[model samples]
Target: MKFLADNKRTLDALNNWVPNPIILSSFFWGAGNVDQRSIDGLLCSLLHQLLKAEPGLGPQLLTRYPEWTDRATYHDWSNKELETALFLAWDLPTRTASLSSLLPAAEAGIQGSMQTMHF
Candidate 1:
């Protein structure tokens, strides 16, 4: 699967490159919890968190965003809670999240946040 493919790419890139682990932050549309429904967004979100946490990446920082979920939803995701939420929301099968949805949602969320921050 492309998800695994991309994860492998990023992980391999991270593993082979021995350094202080500075993530080149993506121009993510928003902040707070990262959107991880797709590889592109996942890459950016991971980079953002990595950069935010690692002093070597840049200045210390944090992010905010919409459809709030954490970076763990990427590599560290577990399905049970989400499945339970779906079950509680509706006693029917839910469509998988769209790979296309993440960017626009993130953009809107970020724009809202930036406006709030008066940037």
Candidate 2:
């Protein structure tokens, strides 16, 4: 997966063939880091990438969850919140292609997460 992500020619070809394509890629580790393999972590990482690609989504996210910008009251984001944010980013008109590589052991949890998101 990393190889595919690093291939500029392939990425360029994909973008050319797909209209307004936004490529999102993520890799999960299974080195006993629960957070890295959790749905919350996955959503957070994807949301970060999405926001970087489209700053327009930031305003909407802030509007939906204003406390996100307030460190004083900031808490670990719930999976629901993160999922909602990801959905919002995903619902945009632009086409998005997601490529995720996860360890076999973490498949169930990740699949459950996607199911909840109706992905």
Candidate 3:
């Protein structure tokens, strides 16, 4: 929930409880559109949010995938590429990025992604 992410008191408590203090969340609303509910879309949204929060990860990502260094073609992300990018973000040495996604229970595709992540 947004409250969990915005509440500073709770976040402070969580910071003491977890090694990696930063908490990020993404909410998925289908709005009756198939593309909006796909895993690729979720990855893109999550990656963008992650990059904004931790700009350091951007160079690491570029290091691994040199082709993406060019901003002109950065938007052309495939599903597999997005998944790989997320993995690379997670693999960063000092940064431990955590993401929570709110998915529609009825949307099987997104639900599958949650299951894959062991959520």
- Which of the two, 1 or 3, has more TM-score? 3
Give the Cα-based TM-score of candidate 3 against the true structure: 0.73
RMSD (Cα, Å) for all candidates, in order, is 15.9, 2.9, 3.1
Q: Find the 10 residues in a row with the least total lDDT in model 1.
A: 92-101
lDDT of 2 at 1: 83
Model 1 lDDT on a 0 to 1 scale: 0.35
Q: What lDDT tens digits, residue by residue, belong to model 1 across residues 6-95?
A: 454655565566433322323334444554433335444434444345434232121212222453553443333332222232222221
- Candidate 3 Cα errors over 4 Å, as ranges: 18-20, 32-36, 70-75, 94-99, 105-107
List residue ranges in candidate 1 displaced over 4 A.
1-35, 59-119
Per-prediction tally of clashes: 6, 0, 0
For candidate 2, write residues 44-93 as lDDT tens digits: 77888888888888888788778877633213666677777799878865
In model 1, what is the error at residue 21, expressed in angstroms? 12
Predictions ranked by lDDT, top down? 2, 3, 1
TM-score per candidate, in order?
A: 0.21, 0.77, 0.73
Give the alpha-carbon lDDT of every model. Answer: 0.35, 0.72, 0.66
